[model samples]
Target: MRIRATVATVTAAALSAALAVTALAAPAAGAEQDDTPTQIKNIEVNQNRDYTVVVEAARKVKFPISALVHDPSGIKSVSFSLQHGATEAEVDGRIAQVGPSRCVKVDESWSKCEAVMIADPYTNVRSNALAGAWGINIVAVDGEGNVTREDYMPLARIKRKTHLSLADATPEPVKKGKNLTVKARMIVASWEKHKDVPLIGHQVLLQFRQGASGPFKTLKKVRTDRNGWATATVQATVDGQYRYDFAGTSLTQARSGLADFVDVK
Candidate 1:
């Protein structure tokens, strides 16, 4: 059984700001019914040099989405959308539609279609309630009125932009063998607050490197506290730089903080 999705149109201004909206010609009126089902294949989505869709603050963002549509009766139109909640009723109003345009007929039975997926923090994702995996929805139609849809397919994860900071690394010019404490904080962009806040109970790595050229070696691993602070102490041995690293999780992006140089006298 094929489930139909209710796709809402994004604002004209938002579409104009995102990309040039072109209207793909639909099949002519009174087209004959061929009983052929449209099939969507080879779908791809990309943004921020990654498969994951990264949403930012301020204005709307656009990314390219491409797919191949096949139907023996001839292709009509193809479009894409986003779904974030468990049920269609929950996410129906939040649907971010990718304007159907830029489709080229490969042959009589196949067409290559490309569209831009728009992410507007202000409109589409107004709050954290719409966070997490925003599934990709593809809808294809054939000239014979036969329809095919891939609903809420988890192609790539949708994540808000995140950042990590090495707030402080103490004992700047400590004597050899003395203990030096390193402090850091991890924060993620909040859609509701519109600011970055500390992310708690996450693992962080304490790393050190000699001078400014070589790779940083992990000294110890520590987890962040309720206050979103990760602290670890290490004995001063040689002159080098210390830093904090977060491998991140499925919900966040991996980040490395700035290294703090400490002179061991």
Candidate 2:
């Protein structure tokens, strides 16, 4: 009877150990999939749909970026990167990254994250040649270690700040129906010198309005010369204002010069 009791106790202990192992291996109730990736949504940079970054000088310019993220396992981090090119080979040496920012919890499954990008042309202009359109890259991680990476999304355009100045309109008092010359110059901000430099070989529009307060009409388009000068000769029809307008290009910003009033005799 004693030997039979010892064998029964060993069998019962073995059965209990197997049952405990099975319970430990099973998933808990209401558990989520550990492989689900975090989702990114509603990304906005500086609250502008088409945010244009104009580098005025050799200084640093800062802007805010925000996004909404969702994950079943909860959000761990959200990061941002500013890139110039599309492929990895193109952006390998020209990328700017902002580390994970504080995220505000919206719910059990969603969070809002915010970050800032500082564009310094004097220091980091090598990133994408320091001009034209740039993209924003995003990477999100969930509580379960699942990650989601999005690359090369349209975020902002980096352009050089420019100005148009109407130098002169001569003759000041000219007879109606006579040829009048309008002179202008186009200059852009230089990142290295922090000064205005000539922007040559660019188109500038000569615009005229009948009065001091009215819609102006484009008279003609003239290209800037080697001296950054754009000149147009038009018939002086009446007493009005003349100005130069730059519609902007891929690397420069649009600018309208102050009007120069002329009296018709």
Candidate 3:
């Protein structure tokens, strides 16, 4: 009886160890799969169903137009065309637009030649858009009804290269009907890199916007110099609160999308 009990105890111990090992291994495998980008070639969409555009970073996240898009009357399916701050945004999912900012493609879908859905809405002057804190826009229902149109931004992956500062970190707020000359100093504890691989001297993309709903606007914004320093001045026309963000192509140690707000009223 003594020997039998001892054997049972050893068996139980081995089983426990195996179970623990498996538990740890399972999560790691799942995480890798989640982070891995999906492979798809094109983006195509029809009217009726609205498109949700999300831009978090600079890399082009691949998505299969058929994975979640069902071919139906309301366009249960869609695609994306992404252009990091260049005029034409991504089309269905892979066409690169680099001309104007009014139409991603006038083939049928309404788009800016080179436009950000929510950011500047102005891409003609955008340079190094993918390198800083910029907003991305998707062309959803133009009129908000069942219409025959090529869907823009069928899917979105919220990715960003820079780390945003904390909200309320910028200068003080100003009242409405005013403009701003935003500026700040960020200590470059260390340098960061971007997936877009900006030039040698360019380190950060400086941007500003009025209120929370305004496009990630940039008015005379400056790029980060060799010392990892940057500054920008934004002019607001009708603002309640104005804010700006310091963003890099690489992750900011402080955080991504860090912002400081000021009231205009």
> Per-model C-alpha lDDT, please?
0.69, 0.72, 0.32
TM-score of 3: 0.27
Which residue ranges in model 3 land beyond 4 Å of their true spot?
A: 1-164, 167-171, 175-179, 184-200, 240-256
Best by TM-score: 2
TM-scores vs. true structure, each candidate: 0.76, 0.79, 0.27
In terms of lDDT, the poorest run of 10 residues in model 1 is 17-26
After superposition on all C-alphas, the RMSD of every candidate to the true structure, in Å, is: 6.3, 14.5, 21.6
Question: Per-residue alpha-carbon lDDT of model 3 for 51-85, expressed as tens digits?
Answer: 22222222332222221211121221122233332
Residues 224-265, candidate 2: write the lDDT tens digits.
998789999999988899999999977788999988999999
Candidate 3 yields a Cα-based lDDT of 0.32
Winner on lDDT between 2 and 3 is: 2
Error of 3 at 261 (Å): 2.5
Q: Clash totals for all models, in order? A: 0, 0, 48
What lDDT is obtained when candidate 2 is compared to the true structure?
A: 0.72
